[model samples]
Target: MKFTKLTSSVLAGATLLSIMAPTASFAATSKAGSADAKTNDNGGTKLPQNDHTEVGISFGDNNSNGNTGYLRLQAVPHTLDFGNHKLLDDSKLDFTADGKNTSLSVNNTKGSFNGTNANQTTTLATGTDTALDTVKGTAWATVVDKQVTRIDPMNGPEDTSDPTNPKPTSGFHKGTDSVAGTWTLSVQATSPLTAVDNGDPSKEIVDENGAKEEIKDAKLTFSDTQYAQTQNVLGLTKDKNDNTYAKDLADLTKQPTVAPVKEITKNVSTPLVANGSDITVAKAAAGEGQGANVFGWLPENIKLTMPAGAAVSNAIYKANLTWTLNSTVA
Candidate 1:
């Protein structure tokens, strides 16, 4: 499940107008003389007028003047469906799978244009079980979530969202400031894989002879692999001595990586930090647009090792994974 909320405040600022001076008019009349008589008279003064009385602008949390800033994160592959695993008995059995097989992604949006922290730290927490399991179903393993060490983002050349480009999504401009800052994300699985028998109506695990059983001796571990597009693409380049200038979004060296795989157990918190990742996910210059999507694929490696004396249930197994992305930086 996902939840989100944002707080916005309009920093109404004062607008100043320099007052202008009043205009004056005068006419002079001189007494009649023999040949060179003249007359002059003076009229009062007229005050200057202004059309506007108030001058104010709105701003956000960052160095924004009459602009807005925001941070957003969304889970990719909303559901991690590890499909179809066969049952094994007595001897230990194992199954290994990848996250990419399920199509995983984490979409993020950060900007200092309106807020100061263009960079955010993301963390994951395990949550509830799925509908396929009983209310008090026992988890198959002590640990469930794991990740590899942080890896560079697949910093392919800036794309024009062209179908011909590898992993194409969007493009970066030459003058706009790409989203600058480092952000990290973590993934978590709250429950264990439970096998529901094909004959049982409650979706409970069953023995060969047909007795309900809970396979608590099974261990499920998670892993990940990071990849980048390496074909004909446009990349952002920068001067090594200068930080303020870049050729385009592809010019920046934003990269993301998967940290070493972690072993997740029930009730034990396994925190996966983005150790060496950068903004290669997507690049944005100021005012290019809102929420430019930087798309990348994550291949998850899942291994299920069953202990000896495990039940032999010939049915499909299922589990729930909760991927949480936090903005709290440590």
Candidate 2:
């Protein structure tokens, strides 16, 4: 019985050893690296990056809305006043206005460097001052004396005649181009000016001598005149001054004073301020730097054309002007 018991115990012990050996082997492999072990990694790798952008532009009354550029325009004296004056017979008076006396200024900081357009222009128009007695025509007229000539300040003597020699107005019209473009300044009168006594064209007026007399048919005119700044590129040649003073005022009769006189045309007369004529006042080309005092004036002149026997009146006569500024890229 004892021998059988011993044999049974030995076989059981051997079976237990076999199970323990397998467990120990698994524990050792999990805790340490094996030279025979091979790693197969199947995966993807990534890298990073950045981006880009830009903006746009425009011009006008409102310029603060995120645009890339802008332009601004203004008239110095909002109102231009030609004070009261007494009209005399036979004797002619020289009446003119320009940047020195009457001025229009332009201020531009435009950053639109896209085109070759570096040009700007200013113009004028006139209207009847009163609505009381409607006159048949404009109260004022401009005429450049045909026989006169513009005297260059840098060259010589000023013409001493009425509607004196055309010259640059004192320090009035001036401009500077930060961008690239040309600027043209122009003017016109578009008012129907009429003379009347208590609004009646046939009323009589008391003269300085206290004589009540009929007002003669007066002539008002704008002399067709043009003047230009001397341009001397490369100091190559003599600077040519504007010779408009030497030219004749377009015959008011030939060039009807009822239409705008913009450009000089053969029979197309530049009418009174009532007619919208694009009169050239000043100009600045690209690269001309800042132009100062480029000037032109529409001198209004009145003449008693009717014979000495017209009836006159004792009343205040007035006229109004509508000056316009037109701009374009050249």
Candidate 3:
């Protein structure tokens, strides 16, 4: 019975070994299949998956946008009116006036009366009618208001009118991006003062002998010149005492400030000569005078002077003036 039992135990052990061997072989085959799958995935071919798009832009003159990258002269005076006067005598008469008032009048005449009859009382009339042996005259000039600008091509224009955009303030802040360069404002008289007959627009005023009358030595003076920025980049501030001052906030030595419009002939009487050299009224040097600037003279400071002898007839004398703006990098 012991031998039979031993033999049966051995057979059971053999059956268990056969089952374990089959299970081990199946596990090894499954692992190999998994390895092959991983290898195939890593080596799988890939096709290119790329795409493309495009972008574009354009520029133009749009007034609402507040033209940027430009140095511009925005405003100027249109007329300098020298009021009416009388030629009572042949003595040299000087007529000084402004955009509003006049220095010489019927009662306030300047210079000595060189008439042969010193005691002769002459009736001074204030109308367009030509009195006996008396002359009524008016002097005026047509001034052209030139608006000039220089644009930079390197940068796109900015819309300064937008509230969200940065602007030049009163304090010492970083300067706004602009077309940085040099510029000048100049004036010239294109023609001499010529007297025209009031009765006929096409005819010139002539003397008793029909000689064409002209004022060759006529002069126009501009003073108290001032400048302003359209954007109000630099503004005025009042102190405790109510004294006004320029609000300039720049450490001039370090970074360039938006330069103030400088009057080259400030407080000086600049002559307006016909067909003469250009007179620079205001100027901005390199790294200065950015944005829109305007140059103007005080009404009280604008004066026109002419010799009394030039008032030969009862007529209106007219002249032409041209303003110029120049922009440069140097």
Candidate 4:
């Protein structure tokens, strides 16, 4: 019985050894596979759809977008006062004394005065010292003349503290989107200079033959005319030696600036007849008169020539002058 039991135990131990041998072989294979394992890495990339953006612009006082881009008449002379003239019996009513008439003065009823003599009032005849006393006669008919694309109204309280840098109560600004183009300025006499009856202000003075007393063959003349730009791009300025020169405000290396050196039309001695056609005083070609420009006329140069023997009268005579500005040059 003991021999048989020993044989069975030996067989059992052999079976257990076979099972443990297989388990050990599987563990050894797993460790070898882990030590020789390989790994992989991945990468990704992206691109932008667009790289830029755009902006828009426009001009004028029509919109509330704060864009100012339109041609405008900034200022003009409202009154060209030829002071009271004493009607002499034998003297011809001529103010054209080779542009030396001391009786002529321009009263700027419109726009700001930028003249060196702003408060100067000329007293043609002897009189009391009044505001009108400073109405001094000048050889030049100076007006606050400006032609611009845009202008700004007085924004806040004016600073009158400094005289040299007198803060302009009003100013003009160049439009960001302004288109450079041509322009024109013209003048016309709407009415004839007729004498008003002494007895009646409404009625005209008539002669013995019932003819209306009028200054016949009278001509308005302008001489030594010049135009200046606020930006100083183009204008006529005099040197210290009284020699006039065309001021070029562009770089010397670039093309010359376009401007007028003389009057557009020679309406010098020609009569500006009543109800006559429009006469061009000044003009600007394409790419010329841009930004704020001023027109200066020698006051003495602006004269009225009256022919002799135009019927005697002790009455006041009056006439009307109409100035027109057009965006497109004619």
Candidate 5:
């Protein structure tokens, strides 16, 4: 490939960056278990037993149910350094909330690793502190002179109106005029339900319930952040003063705020199936690890919608989510 002087310089810079790029890697692991079992009041060293016992031999079915959630999402941290070496705006961009392992286990099912997932979402309330005191935020984000760039076509006959590349779906907004505003953030979603009330079983029919009762204590918080961490892979490069910085591309790709222009939600619900066999295990003597995999590949749909708003620098708004279970234990 041929390279002009400018292209060569850019390519050389990129290659140099590739070699000296600094990477930040972190690793963490955890294990935890909790059971809502019975306990004796006396200071007695006594053991309990399960109700389900094998013929004469008394085989105790065990259950070691647990979930170990792990989240390893990378973020890009930006630092706004003041001339005195003080940081003005340090932003930590949590681009993703990666993994949340929800699980259950029974003894005989030790080899089986399966789980059911219930969503928990909170409705964004009407009144929120969306108003950022820009005057006081001079340290976080100084309002530089906003410019209106008519990103029409370059070096071509342009028209104020065109079909294919029409005005922005976000609206034909000018620079500063569209930049600042009284942005109102609202939570919007659709919840669907279906049921088989007073079902007929004689004709081989199964009963049904609409939507599961949603869980409680959902929350949404909004705030501005500064000083985000960076992720680099090769662990080589450094800034001008040889200060290394790592920026993770994978993390940046996970932010909900950055969902593409063509994405949309459709509300739908999947039916839960309850298999026949039921085991009777006493709560007092329930051994370690004894549960079957109930949750299969079932997808429930949730439709979402909201109005567009301006995103100021070093600002972030988070929505805590939750959902109700069918309570059917199916």
Candidate 6:
């Protein structure tokens, strides 16, 4: 059960235009599963589609001298539309990920293990286990509304027709379809390494009552050159009916591109705030920084897959994506 609401605001924020529309609450959106890649009866995709935008982000500082200065640029919508897309699951994505992050600090210059003071004191960082760390999150996507309309490649450019109106039982037919892509992603702690901040790390973890606890700038690291997962898609139908009432009206209305496809991948390197919402962009804007961000000019990992169908069809089937990250999330 899907719904469609065409709003002017959503069109303004293409990141690729920056528009504003209050955030939509995710009261009960289903979590991503194997359905992350699926098709529908009409060949339409199920994935949410939208544009992107860039906004100033403040992720604290990186220097140890209390001169913090690390920025973050939020990507609006975080979704894409294939116009007329399809997702053939059961196909595998050659996905892979690898990255490292640090979050430990010390301050025991007065002379303690590592560093455990409140001032900018120099102290040795002792070795600690990296398994004591962990992070939890998910990553999945899907497409919806495969074919918008079946076209009859026989009309001229000047043909007069109200595309959005009720149509007649004419023999000729032609139209556009909607292909979409969407995902639900998350990240979690999964490391045995502790930020042996030997120093007093409590200041970084502010308490609800303004009190502070020591949480070293330690980090959790992981490296998986491959994040491959197979998708089992459904919703493709076989609706090839000819009602042209003629000896051979096959030329009257051309058939739509009902090609059955599989495998599509998007390589993305996104940093998830340990306990922050992965917000979506509502629109895009035209500006110097509209397309680029602090992370880089584009998504750290953004690649879409093009699956191969029948074996005798000679189409190839393969997905290869890699990503990495280095950030702080408490």
Q: Which candidate number maximizes lDDT?
A: 4
> Between 2 and 4, whose lDDT is larger?
4
Q: Give per-model TM-scores.
A: 0.30, 0.27, 0.46, 0.44, 0.16, 0.18
Any runs in candidate 4 off by more than 4 Å, and if so which? 1-69, 88-92, 96-177, 197-212, 232-272
What is the number of backbone collisions in each predicted candidate, taken in the order shown?
Answer: 47, 63, 2, 10, 44, 104
lDDT of 3 at 154: 38
How many residue-pair clashes does candidate 1 contain? 47
Estimate the overall C-alpha local distance difference test score of candidate 6: 0.22
- lDDT string for model 1 (296-316, tens) is 222124444556665555454
Instruction: Summarize candidate 5's per-residue lDDT along 100-150 as a digit string, tens digits.
Output: 211211111111111113222211111222222221122111111101111
State the lDDT of candidate 6 residue by residue for 206-316, as single tens digits. Answer: 347954332222221122211211111111110122122121223424532322212211222322223322222111111111111211111112222222341211111
In model 4, the clashing pairs are 60-69, 120-134, 121-134, 121-135, 121-136, 122-134, 122-135, 122-136, 140-299, 141-299
- Candidate 3 weakest lDDT stretch, 10 residues: 236-245
For candidate 6, give the lDDT of residue 3. Answer: 27
Q: Which portions of model 5 show Cα errors greater than 4 Å?
A: 1-147, 151-207, 220-330
* Candidate 3: residue pairs that collide: 93-308, 172-249
Candidate 3 regions off by >4 Å?
A: 1-69, 88-92, 96-103, 107-178, 199-212, 230-257, 267-273
lDDT of 4 by residue, 1-330 (tens): 999999999999999988888543332234333444341111121221247777866321111222122444443444443434434333545553222233432322212111222222221221232322222232221111223322245546678899779785544343222233466777777767777765564677777999876766666666655554433211211112111112322322344344432335534334645786687776765566554445545455567666666664546665666766666632
Off by over 4 Å in 1: 1-71, 78-86, 89-92, 98-179, 196-213, 227-300
Write the residue-wise lDDT of candidate 3 on 9-98 in tens digits. Answer: 999999998888843333223433434545443243332335788785522111121222233333344444455444523443444343
Q: In terms of TM-score, which candidate is stronger, 3 or 6?
A: 3
lDDT of each: 0.30, 0.29, 0.44, 0.45, 0.20, 0.22
Error of 3 at 142 (Å): 17
Measured over all alpha carbons after superposition, the RMSD of each candidate to the real structure, in angstroms, is 26.6, 29.3, 32.1, 31.7, 35.0, 32.4
Q: Which scores better on lDDT, 1 or 5?
A: 1
